[model samples]
Target: MNDFPWLSVLIALPLVGAVAVALLPRDRETLAKQAAFGISAVVGVLAIVMATGFDSDGARFQFTETHWWIKQFGVHWALGVDGIALTLILLSVVLVPLVILASWSDAERSGGVDGAPPKGSVKTYFALILALEAAMIGVFAATDVFLFYVFFEAMLIPVYFIIGFYGGPQRSYAAVKFLLYSLFGGLLMLVSVIWLFPLSAKPVGEGGLGHGTFLFTELNTMHVDPTTAKWLFLGFFVAFAIKAPMVPVHTWLPDAAQQSPAGALVLIVGVLDKVGTYGMLRFCLELFPGAAKWATPVVLALAVVSVIYGAVLAIGQVDLKRLVAYTSVSHFGFIVLGVFAMTTAGQSGAALYMINHGFATGALFLLVGFMIVRRRSARISDFGGVQKKAPVLAGLFLIAGLAGLSMPGLSPFVSEFMVLAGTFTRHRVPAIIATFGVVLAAIYILWMYQRTMGGPVREGNESILDLTAREKWAVGPIIAVIIAMGVYPQPVLNIINPSVHHTLARLDRPDPAAKIHVAEKVAENGARP
Candidate 1:
């Protein structure tokens, strides 16, 4: 199993399925959908197999395979996984099949409210989805910086079409905005990637490249001057922040989410957006520790602002899809905060939060989508006493909502607690401010529920049906996992701790408590007779 090239198989399987789907007659929509779902399911099972075989005690990249891809520039087609990458990869694979299942029927629906049949072939829709899955796996698993960048940029293409071709009236605008923002960031990162190559080319004997490679292992050992590292760090950070969709840059998300299909929105917000926070951990902090430390104050501030700003905006949203999108901005803020806290506990919490947020948010989007389909409207005002008509659906919505607000005994609560606790130990003021975001979370969630599900059955809502077998299957595993992770996070924490320590070691930044302890020891020694 060690030499089986599981990573390559994982990356390629979906693409193969995509090809198979594309080759089928364009009119064979059902077959195309089935093939796509089957492929994603197989990939999901393989991911589980890979996880079970992974070394939880190991800190270094595992299941690694490297082959020179661009020897001219010393880049390799390197692939591997550490605890962090593995967690995100698991999130990506697990969600893909569920998204496919959720979309099975929706893909056949007409484009928008009161619109004609979909303009594109269902085969193409599912094909693009499968292709997106492969790119996501590559993004998380790639060990080569150049290879990572390639996957990173390639990811945008399918998502662009998914939104533009399958989305709402404003999809074209949303798709264009998303692409421009992503491309701009990718360009900045490309500059940084190019700059690092020459710096990494020099031999290690002369304090330069160890193997003249883009492999993270080789690059981790190469040191850059402080000024240059900071510049490069900005190039990478800006790209990630945009992807993270933090505040000012977050405008695109609500538009994109509103225009996109619910299933595709699941991947957009759940796995795709994670690339930003993931990159911050993988590239910004790992490769430029000095710059990370230097930029900490500003990053933390933006994170805090995003937390508060996104929640407040969510409270004001009339569109259900757009509301969920804004809430993600808030959730992602916590993720970034945890990552930049520079503590082992904080980083581990951040990693777990990424996974938990995916489940929680995905449920919210899908459930809300269920409501929209029934009402044929996205307006929150269009719903009222929905619970009275569809008690089961309302119950599921409550579970997802409770998880979203980080209520106790749900997956998100555990991770959110860890993030806050860890951040408090390092930066009390920021932690305190972030807690207020949680308060706003409860306000928005409960308020939205009251407006949409509570009260007497509204006239239009009385005829609505409860969740179908398919919808139940779609949400059952998510709810079960949410409760299970909340009760027992140790399974995930065990996998996360080793890599968290490794990352902190690379940063060379001691825990705040450790620094305080050292200071006390030095002062006592100075006072000794």
Candidate 2:
């Protein structure tokens, strides 16, 4: 059973679904949506079944399938997943169906959304969604560097159209900016990936494998000089940072999120952005440990900046979508910070953060999307006292908002706590400063909630309806998962810890033990007196 090509099946199912969904007549918008949702749900279920078969302690990468796709370049149609990759794939599949459900009517009418007349039909909108889901799963599952890159770049297409044709007025500009930034990053990564080939092809006598290959496991054994490794690391890191949408490079995200449909934005920020941080953990740290360690200081500094800057900016946004977008920028900073902190707790926290952020932010975006559908506005001032009219909607928004802020007994809080705790164990000062981002998170999430869901029921908001049965179904699972994970995270951690330890072993680093004992001693000196 384990030998079955589960990952390929996972990828192919969604692609076939996309084609099937697309072939539906344009007039059959409802059928198109139902077909898309059903397909995504099946994919999600299949992924869950695959996860059940995974033995996290048995091997670093499982469900292995390796066949040469390009013999000349030694690239393989390899696919596998470690704990990190498996969890992320799960996050992607789980969200796709819900996104489809949440967006059922979002594209039904071209004129209803804020964009210029829609250029794509409703069937196309849902088809693009399924296509994006396929690419996302493939990227997470690919263990070959070249195959990973292929899936990485392919993900941009459906997303670009989803934004460009079915989103807000500025979607064209947003999609263009997104494409340009991504292509620039991807080109650099391609250079680095190409560079790895010759590095791997060098003679074994010269610390090389004596043959060209892009299989991740083989390349992990290849040796490159520090200078070359640093350059290669930088190439890959920049691409991921842009995707992670870290500070400076992250300018593309807010614009993209602002222009994206609520459903697409959920996938963009929730799953797509994660590819960046996951790349850092998998490729940068494991493949270029020295460069990763050397680059830690600068990366940590930038992560801290992203944390504070994103939160501060989110607090000030009048546009509801942009505000949530900025909060993601801030949330991602924590993920990056934890990754570079380079400790077991830190990296594990980083991995878990990716999943938690997906559900937390996804729910927020969907609920907000629901609000926008009724009011046809994304401005904070455009809403008030929504709780008076739609109590259930307002209540769910409050829970999701609190989760975003990392309030206690929520999954986001658990992940955030682990990140801060992990970082503190290794890098204290940056961890301290990054805590301010937490305070700012509270301010932004609460302030936005207060403005949109609080106060007297504004004249127009009085008639705003509660969540429909379908919307409740779409969001219910996420909320349950959040609470369940928040209360007990050990099950997921069991699946994540083995991969993290193996990655750390690859770096030849372990938790600094003697020094921690010494630090405790220093704190105890003369303290009893």
Candidate 3:
């Protein structure tokens, strides 16, 4: 056994930091902010250490920790990391510090004397941000079904407050809408989990829920009827899809994105939203392979609609944040398409897409925030000729915007290509239509760039300064990583492949919709029992 409980350390550090921030004296607001940042930075460092030691070649969970948590329910305090979990956890760590940093000026500005947020509010805000970090890490690290559910639900608390208390004019309404929608989704998932708990209680021969434990490992080994499994699968899918903000359930995301503080927007869209796609992979696909296969065509159709719909909507948006938010819908459609395609390259591409989307989209949101901070506006038409006034800022925006459009040398290009290639191997018609999304992406992305960054310098824009040293530090590395990933994506692919293969192997049921050369049913019926 490993001497240290590293996984626990990851969760505990931030929880403790949050508590510390919460307890700080009102007079020491700056101290409280510093404490939160210091704690988050420390956690980020520890996460990087964990990454260095992570066994990329191995598909099994690492740094695993488990102990009895609730005897009556057979729930355990289990935690671990695979490549999927690792990438998300790293994302959490990376973003928390940036979020804290992003809010520093806003927090102080809002807390000042006239029409500003009170000093006490800053401390509380930072505390909530730290708490959010802990919960996000927990969601990804959890291995037990119960523990995962706990973390999954726990995340909304910080997010709700972040939007409600710190957001724009319609903060309250937006927060409530976000809360009710997510809670509705979460409640459905809770009902599903409650039903799922018993599936593990059966014995193999008697069909007595199979393993009698809530462990994902054990549950993954048990088989459920395809008929009964699809409903359970939908329960999880709806919840995750809402979080993924796919299609109809996606109405809340743009509002939340529009109204939320810059820090919260980064985490919500960049990292938290990924949990939805992750759930589809971890729960829906792995546990209900037959159902997932059965549902692929429908899901793929919705994905195509979202891709086109989001692109079309984005083109019409005046609010920059809302435009970026809609782009995520289109981006997630590609992700979902890759996922349900169920090919090796497709799944890996999906996984890679998550990381790239986070970086690219997160950068876009951050750049927008920076612009809003300087100009006191988020309207696409508010200013132009930014390249002349703030060349570095405009340049970074171009890089991020180009990345969004999936320029060939950017990280998204590699992932998007793989997704298209993999999907074509399975669903040629849908693949062809999905290609239209790329064209749409180019249109919206380039148009947004041209509107915001091109044209003559506006009169008031003359006073605007280029990116600050601190701002450069904040966004530069994110851009660098995007470029690095684009230039050499092999390492990420290598790390992700092992886990993807293992997951696919566990999906033992044949994909009915798949164009298999041999009829699996005929072969099965012909085989000796």
- Whole-model alpha-carbon lDDT for candidate 1: 0.88
lDDT of model 2, residue 515: 36
Candidate 3 residue spans exceeding 4 A from truth: 1-3, 110-120, 204-211, 509-529
Quantify all predictions' global Cα lDDT against the true fold: 0.88, 0.89, 0.84
RMSD of 2: 4.2
- Candidate no. 2 TM-score: 0.95
lDDT for each residue of candidate 2 in 305-394, tens digit (9 for 90 to 100): 999999999999998889999999999999999898877777877898899999999999999899988887788998999988899999
Q: Rank the candidates by lDDT, best first.
A: 2, 1, 3
Candidate 3: the clashing residue pairs are 110-117, 111-117, 200-212, 202-208, 202-209, 202-210, 203-208
* TM-scores for all predictions: 0.95, 0.95, 0.93
Q: How many residue-pair clashes does candidate 1 contain? A: 1
Error of 1 at 362 (Å): 0.6
Residue-wise C-alpha lDDT for candidate 1, range 347-445, written one tens digit per residue? 877988999999999999989888988998899998999998999999999999999999877888767776777787889899999999999999999
Off by over 4 Å in 1: 114-117, 204-211, 514-529
